[model samples]
Target: MKRAYVLVTADKMSIRKAAWQCGVPIQTLRDRLERGVNQARPLGGDPLLSRSEEEGLVKHIEYLAKCGYPLTRKDVINLATETAIFLKKRPQNAGNLSKRWFVRFMSRWPELRLAKAQKLSMKRAKATSDETVQSYFQELDRILTKYDIKNKPHLIYNVDETGFQMEHTPSKVVGPRGLKLNAITSERGPTTTLLACGNAVGTCLPPYFVFKGARYDARLMAGAVPGSKCSMSKSGWSNGNIFKHFLEEHFIPFLPQRKPDDHVLLLYDGHTSHISIPLIELAKEHKIILFVLPPHTSHVLQPLDVGLFKPLKTFQNACGARMRESPGEVITRYDVCNLASKSFLKAFTPINFINSFRKTGIFPFNPQEIDQTMFEPAKNLARNHWQTEGEEESVEKGNMEKLNQFFSSRLPTPKEPKSHPKKRKVSYRPGGVAITEETIILKIRKVYADGDDAHIHPDNSLGEVSGEGRKRANVTQEESDSDDETDDVCCVCNKFSPDGLNKLNYLKIVDWAQCDLCNHWVHLEFCDRRNVNDIRSGPYRCIHCVSLEE
Candidate 1:
């Protein structure tokens, strides 16, 4: 108990007070505190039983617990009876136990031990970039960039294909404006695939459609060839099957039928077939030049690689609109073939194909300079209100005045101050004259194919500079586009602005337009804004893309 007094005194109290509060005499507490030792309780004279009997009782209690007997006074009594009989044979203690019976004991007690304390070491490490293997393609890309085509125009074919499965992945989505906070989102999907192969001068080598069946194979590849192993994989989407089939079939057959000297140059990705043994042998034999782009560079390098796929997807979704009544919505192998035919035909029709490519801006040069855009959610450009089943145009809900007022808030508007007037400037230069134009031509810089940056002068006047020294016009959309609707899309990415539905006088940041199909901004143009042109472009997010390249 004196040990308890020390603990009490440790909490900001005198030993005398602690002892007093603990109801122990100061002298007794003082005697116990002479050393850090706890005293066993003093024994009183036990006239009831002897010490040997009490020890025997403890042993019996332990025996009863070990024997699976429930602890009770009766159990202890029976155990003691049996133990006493055993003790009759051999008794341990001969000491008097008259005073031992005065105390009580618990069955179990906790055992304590000392624990060792130690310290641990912590260190950090670094790693190299994960794309070490993929970089080899970059060198390959340089070789292709310099390699010339066999024929000037007609014989040069960028023959390639693509594939897809109907699967959706978890993707993060964003919300519209005006929320205190916007959370990310996810969605499920319908899917499709398109394969486009064509030449540099806007001629298609014969596009293929992607299907899930086994119609694609080595023989398919052989059929795609004219007579030799090298041919267009346009027999089907760019798959392992078509990859093999092209080397086996159409590749060499598609060679110049008329001009023996005419050779075909194939610009495609590094799919297995393009580099496979069969295809390689055919190329060497037939002198077919195969140019496969670098890894992660296809969307920016190939013409159809960017924006044309969106229309293909849109077409698939159109086909998928048919409801499935049974376990099969599977378009038959034949149906797939038919769909592939139609999709390729409609998607690659010369005019549509060129328009799509123009939108993507992959046509010219500087593949590294092209935008990487993924597909965007297709919006119905169809107006909300209609005249009736027979109506041709949308109903005008409001008057021109309201419409003008509504549009005024959407774009950067030219200002005429009502409360503040312009101040006259004081002459500072010795010439005594100042440049007083409200416009300044901003130079747009472009990267040339020769790896040099050149500036193109824009026709707009940069009125004032922001705090960051950046210049932008306060021009309204009505004044900027004047008569064109295509300019309503973003000039940087062909995406509708965050405030696009409401924002006015859309400003073009880069010299390009976004493809609605690809949903990316591309095709840096020198065309007049008054007569804007539409083109296909890939869209990139982390990187700008005309498609879901990453």
Candidate 2:
């Protein structure tokens, strides 16, 4: 329309000719000409921040997100409030930062998005410290250079598994304020694991899915991609056997034809199953070199974990949501593979694959890609430890004694309660089995009630009671004896002797770290020896039950 008006006014063209040539109305062209150079009016009212200020804000938020501390909506609103106060632009009508304002604010910044923050434990955070990441890169660089696989983009691949819930609830929804709204979902079901493999150059192999069942039905693969395969596992998790099967059956078969001498480099996490003899044997037989990521550092190092999986999960949820909306549809295990196929097609793009590799410094090797700020928390903690030691050393012995004296004077002394003697004698049952605290308490009550057979022995461990004992009156005997297990075993080594007992005096003192996945305790030292690194900073898995991931 503007072009037609320009032609009519500037080129001496008639209205009819201009309208016919430019395919616009003559009156519309005339109106545009009269209006002069049409300017795009700002849709909403003047922005709270100027263009430069908004740009700076976007940069700041991005920086914070990179620093592992993405701001919440409330945090962003507070920051805006602070900015308004700083700029002396307080509007009388404005109360809290409006939701619409935030929506518009995000619209202006396309690259800046609201993402669900990944929660990291302090141990996990420390595990991804700057030094650890740099070490990983150094080792990766050495390995790539050593094997001359640095330029082998196609040969360099990352494989990771992710789980998709049958009824994947969307992250956000619209609802009225101050009212409860539950997202209606299908029946509760187990997640299906999807094993995805991709190269640094953006080539993706068909996904391998593991479902929880004894047998897989053909209907499960109905809408799946042509070459995709599905397997069944008891827990729907991958084990060494499944991993070996995937490498031999799916992975090796999907690779592009190459010379017998040409080998591929496969990068994966330090899951015990991945390092098993059978998996290693299969990889070696197929001329695939397995490079295991350092323990607890997959979040930053693995290409699939760093980038691809997040989008894949989001897309899967979207697919599940679409499936759910169909009338009378309830998502079952069969529907997941199809939903996953749709998600993989949408999310596993070339850009996502390549970017993940580049960002993690795996391909086109560059260690500087990882920011130093990611390791700040670990460094700060180390620094504070030494500083705390120095301050403790600076304190005088005399001052410490005086402080102790003052605390002693102020502290209330606990008094012993009066005991009621009875004719009943408590009995001692001797056995290798644990005599429950409940049994002892019952015998004590029997003695106090003047029961003749209840005799309390002086050698009994629970013979004495204190003033604080009354506080535990409501505690059940089973609850009291909960910690008296004589046969606790380590999940990894499956041994009992040094497993449950905690004694610092032991020559080789061992601490038990519970697997987050299986909720079974394994010896910390045993985990270290077995290369199970996440035991310390965990959401961990035992060797036998390590994730196939869903």
Candidate 3:
């Protein structure tokens, strides 16, 4: 009896606390003792369930109670009263299990993980329109409608430039490994430069500007092509400089020149260079109305942006690989330009380019007057090796022929015999022309107050006069080194017109010998460009520089 007392208190912590923490129901504790105390971890009486199962049931009951689920008196008893009873239509002869014990037993194995159960696939979101793209379409629609222009094929011209470098390109294409990835190495290869301009109607690819250097700047853009030739200035263009160059040199030329009743509309995407202040100003001056495509839609809207650039790239690579210089210098910008120019002639004939658009499937070309006009605007579009047809496709293949044909024709035409660049007299003060023992030191003490209006420069050259068309007085780099004495005379402030050049003394050809280095059958600076003279007095390396260079 004394040993049994320990189980009554020490064995069950909850029971012990329950007994003293709150005044015990005197009869209840005595009733539990008298009923039974057989479980290993004792509660006051029959728990009617295993300890693990009871713990789980406890959690479930608490959650349901907190969520305020309604419960009947019987359900409450089944939860907390621990009645180990089964009520499955039991008859009087069914074992010794009580109805109460079955209730507790059935509820014991609590399935807590299934508290908020449902199938995963049923939880997907309902369909809805994305506001992002919708807004863009709205804005675009407003613009097109406001301009009173229909959304059709040829009316819009989308232009841009793509680059081909001596290095990596995107896309995992299978090709001739050696030929596919050509770079400027010790061997010669075709350098590539492609300047392109296109719209859904079609693209205008002009003569590619190929040369020695690779770097492209505003000046180079202006120089290789004339401001007049390229119709260019201050800013860049779509495809960067490519579009600007193409538009100025090629596109505009093909386009019918503007007139008073013209209803032509020029549409483009807004690249930094395209919408530059200078470009805008130029557009205004040219009387052109430019419409810009919506931002992200250029992918879907622009014809060239969508499919043409890819094919354009393929031909550029093939042609560029063919331009090889024998192994010393890397292909320069001019080389790329040259290759690109050649590719332009080959890749974008009226037929080939038109065919490319046709193949793209989504092209908006229409047979209706409104649609077809985009492709063939003018009635008498030219036709020749250099001249493009309503659409012309070259049948030529390979390097020499493709390039030589396009390049030769694209070169600036030789000026007429009278339209040659006329030179103005540079007022060289003949400053202190002293004949010292061996050298001549001409230090003219003229006041170059602000160095403005003074042609004399640090290289001891006279300033340039604002000739007929160029802005900012220029010093003719060609004339500086080549002043000769014989057939050439300095007609105005002349001073022998430098060293080797045929002076513009008489508006005609002053027959001198040949330019040895350039081998141009004309007057050159030195007796022979091959000879090397001493350092103290520089030597004329060519027809003009032997004396001037010295």
Q: Which candidate gets the maximum TM-score versus the true structure?
A: 2
Two-way TM-score contest, 1 vs 2, winner = 2
TM-score per candidate: 0.32, 0.55, 0.32
Estimate the lDDT of model 2: 0.61
For model 3, state the Cα shift of residue 407 in Å. Answer: 59
Q: Report lDDT (Cα) of residue 349, candidate 2.
A: 92
User: Residue 456 lDDT in model 1?
Assistant: 12
Residue 78 of model 1: what lDDT? 40
Instruction: Give Cα distance to truth, residue 314, candidate 1, Å.
Output: 2.7
lDDT of 2 at 473: 22
Weakest 10 consecutive residues of candidate 3 by summed lDDT? 120-129
Q: Write the per-residue lDDT of candidate 2 for residues 99-125, one digit (tens) a residue.
A: 878888888778977877756545456
Sort by lDDT, best first: what order?
Answer: 2, 3, 1
Q: What ranges in model 2 sit over 4 Å off?
A: 1-116, 174-182, 314-324, 385-550
Q: Rate the local accuracy (lDDT) of all candidates.
A: 0.35, 0.61, 0.36
* Model 2 lDDT at residue 464: 12
Residues 1-550, candidate 3: write the lDDT tens digits.
2233344566754544555545575456545566764434434555544464344334444433332232344554444332222212234344454556545544554442224321111001110112322443454344345444444444444444443444323334456856855344323322223335554455453544322233444443332322223322111111234444454556665664444534334544443223333343444455444555433333333445444554555533543355343445454433444444444555555555455444433233321211221212121111122222211232333432343333234322323333322232333322111111012112222223433222332212111121221122111100111111111222222222224334445433222232223222222223333322232254123333333335
